[model samples]
Target: MSSMTKIADIEAEIARTQKNKATMAHLCALKARLAQLKRDLIASETKKGGPKGDGFDVQKTGDARIGFIGFPSVGKSTLLNKMTDTFSEVAAYEFTTLTCVPGIVAYRGAKLQMLDLPGIIEGAKDGKGRGRQVIAVARTCSLILIVLDVAKPLQHKLIIERELDGFGIRLNQEPPNIVLKKKDRGGMNIASTCPLTQLDADTIKTILSEYRINNCDIMFKGDYNADQLIDVIEGNRVYIPAVYVLNKIDQISIEELDIVARIPHNCPISAHHDWNLDGLLECIWDHLNFVRLYTKPRGQVPDYNEPVILKKTPQPTVESFCSRIHRQMMKKFKYAWVWGSSVKHQPQRVGKDHLLDDEDVLQIVKKV
Candidate 1:
């Protein structure tokens, strides 16, 4: 039978199986099997051509790329047009914005690329209505702005989250503190720093056995569950930061707005009335965690106009800063002078390997 057919069978079984101590093992095994089948299906599809698509391939620019994702007519186009120079068509109807519309949001001396993507349907993750292609674009983004209308059902938020989840995109979450080291003959050694309440020793063992991980060292630093463990083992998950842009607050009452405001990591604004966008921009900036390096000359003052923006991941250092400025600057590197929060004293000298802080001033001194 085909992978999809097998997957459907396993899913049906899982749905029928009740959750209890008596049937936990069977449920876990079935879930693991379903996961493997999905992985196989993705692998097969990737070998054919991958999930990428035409017109979805936009040139990434600015300090970071942010994708706007939501269902039909969710004020994504309106927000994009208000936030950036790029003019995306805005209409009252659904699915008006059919393609990826690119724009640039210049904020606090930092330029951020904003993409108003096409409206995603419920089954978009299953290759419906350019959903796979849209999510593929989101996978490449540093942050996702989940735009939603306050007038619509709040369940739409869960639906979008589910769609992104199926694509291995873990939003607003960090990678689980779990490690799996393969071994030839040492057998399975398990270790944990925290008390795992949700997952038991047997469940973990059953999961590992299901994946044919006969000999490996498993380490857990957090109290993560089986699904998270599966994600870590699968090793294809993308943990991207996301914020819920709750748009159309102008259409709602003050009491209703209070309810939307209570949602965690969300910003409620009215794109039509241009309300509370500043707060949204600030939230986006904080979520991005961009490192800004001001260029300083030997004698002249720092040029505050253009700052070298670097991503916080992989530990941003002076070497990364130089690479962003010029490719060959690192080879002729002597040392760097730093000013701001990264230094102990005023203008402390640092080397190529020195890590940088956000909004720090840097002066590169090369060898003769």
Candidate 2:
């Protein structure tokens, strides 16, 4: 039988099966089998589809990238036209955008590349109708803007999230504070600084064994669950920040608009009428978590125009800044002088190891 047929059979059986305390292990095994069958089905479909010409993949540019994803007829193309200079075809029909239409959004001295991607259907993650290609493009983006029609029910957001989730895109989530290190001889060593309420020892071993992992060290710095253990085993998951942009607010009532605005990371706006788009852009900027730094000469004023923007990290020291300018500067660098939130005193002489903060002024003096 075909892979789809087999998958359907397994799913049907799983649905028919009942749950009980004694049948938990049986259910787990069946679930694992179902997961394997689904993976096999997806693999077959992807291989049959071969290289697709959905034609949306484009070269990434600008300081950061924002990928637009949603079902068709949700004003994604129109929103792209309004927000950026790109002229994506907008029509009163489905699939007007057949390829990737890229545009630049220059805001606050930071240039953000916004891509208008083709609308995805329900099964896009399963290599259906360029879904894989579109999501692959999204995997590279700094942020995913899930555009939704306010006229429609809000549940569509969950559907879109499920598709992204199946493709290993964990939106608005951090990498789990769990680490799994492989070893040769040790059976399994589990360590935790905090109590783990979401998982137990037996469940952890079951998950590890399902992945054919025999010996490893599992460390949990924070709370985690069984799915997280699977995620750690999968190791191909991408955790990205996502924003839910509610479009077509002009069609809704003012009272309805207030309710939409209350949603987390949600911006209610009209893409057609350009209402509250500035607020949407501001939301995008904040979610990016950008760090902008200015550079100064030894005795001259700092250049405020061309600031070096970097992602925020735990230790954003001078080495991180120097590597951006030139890698060789690290060896020839003597010390750096900082004058901003990262420093205690004004114009403090610091080394390459000195951590930097946003808007910090830096001047590097090289060795003679």
The estimated TM-scores of all candidates read 0.93, 0.91
- CA lDDT, candidate 2, residue 29: 52
lDDT of 1 by residue, 1-368 (tens): 98878977998998898898777777888878878877787677778886465568899988889999999898999999998888999987888987899999888789899999999999887778888889888999999999988877378889999999988999989899999998888778889998988788788889889999989999999999888999988999999999999998878899988887777889998899999999999999989988788999999999998998887776799999999999988999999999989889889999888888888999889899
Overall lDDT per candidate, in order of appearance: 0.88, 0.83
Evaluate model 1: give its TM-score: 0.93
Error of 1 at 14 (Å): 2.5
Residue 174, candidate 1: C-alpha displacement in angstroms:
0.6
Instruction: Give Cα distance to truth, residue 49, candidate 2, Å.
Output: 7.3
Best by TM-score: 1
- As a TM-score, model 2 comes out at 0.91
| Model 1 pairs whose backbones collide | none
Cα error, residue 74 of model 2, in Å, equals 1.1
